[model samples]
Target: MKTVYFVVLLLVALTYFTTIEASAIPHCSPWRCQQECLFKNFMKGECIQLQCVCSQKIGGIRP
Candidate 1:
C-alpha cells in the first residue's frame, strides 16, 4: 500500500514538472533583447564596437 501511494505521488509530481519544461525554453530573441536593453546602462557603448575606444571621456560628457 505504501508503495502504491508513492507511485501516485510521483506521477503527480512528474505531470506538474512536464508543464514546467514546456514553458521554460527560450522562444525568441525579443525577450533576450529587452533583457539586454536593461543592462545597457552598465556597459560602455564604445568598448563594444571600436577597437581602441576608451571608457573615459575628454570632458566628462554624458553621451
Candidate 2:
C-alpha cells in the first residue's frame, strides 16, 4: 500500500512538472516571414503566408 501511494505521488509530480514545462515553452509567431529584410530599408512590408515580406522586390530580388 505504501509503494502504491508513492507511485501515485510520483505520477502526480511528473504530470505537474510536464504541464509547467509545456506552458513555459516559447511560442513562435506565424508571421516570421514578414520581418524586416536586409535591403531597401525604406521599402514597405506586407503579410504573405503569415510572413512579413517586402511589398516591392528590390534589385529584381525579393527582400
Candidate 3:
C-alpha cells in the first residue's frame, strides 16, 4: 500500500526529469555499445543508457 504509492511517486519524478529535459551519459561505460553512444528508445526518449561492446577481429589474409 504505502510502498506502492512511494514507488509510483518515484517513477513520476523520474519521468518528469527524463521527459521535461534530457540528461547526459555517465562515465565508465553504460549498458549499450562501447565507446560513447546515445540510445533513444521510442518517444519515451532516451531513458536507459548502455555501454556494452564486443571485440572481433577480421582476417586480413583473404584470397
For model 2, the local distance difference test gives: 0.63
Ranking by lDDT: 2, 1, 3
Best by lDDT: 2
Model 1 CA lDDT for position 40? 51
Poorest 10 consecutive residues of model 1 by lDDT?
Answer: 45-54
User: Tens-digit lDDT track for model 1 on 1-63?
Assistant: 999999999999998888888568534344444445445532332323323233333344566
TM-scores for every candidate against the unseen true structure: 0.36, 0.38, 0.34
Residue 9: error of model 1 in Å? Answer: 0.5
- Cα RMSD for predicted model 3: 10.9
User: How much lDDT does candidate 1 score?
Assistant: 0.52
* lDDT of every predicted structure (CA atoms): 0.52, 0.63, 0.48
Worst 10 residues of 2 by lDDT: 26-35
Candidate 3 lDDT, tens digit per residue, 1-63? 999999999999999888665555343333334322333211121223443433332333469
TM-score (C-alpha, index-matched) for candidate 1: 0.36
Q: On TM-score, who's better, 2 or 3?
A: 2
- Model 1: colliding residue pairs: none
Name the 10 consecutive residues with the lowest summed lDDT in model 3.
38-47
Can you write out model 2's per-residue Cα lDDT over 1-63, one digit (the tens) per residue?
A: 999999999999999988988668654343443355434552456655644556655556465
Give me the displacement of residue 21 in model 2, in angstroms: 2.9
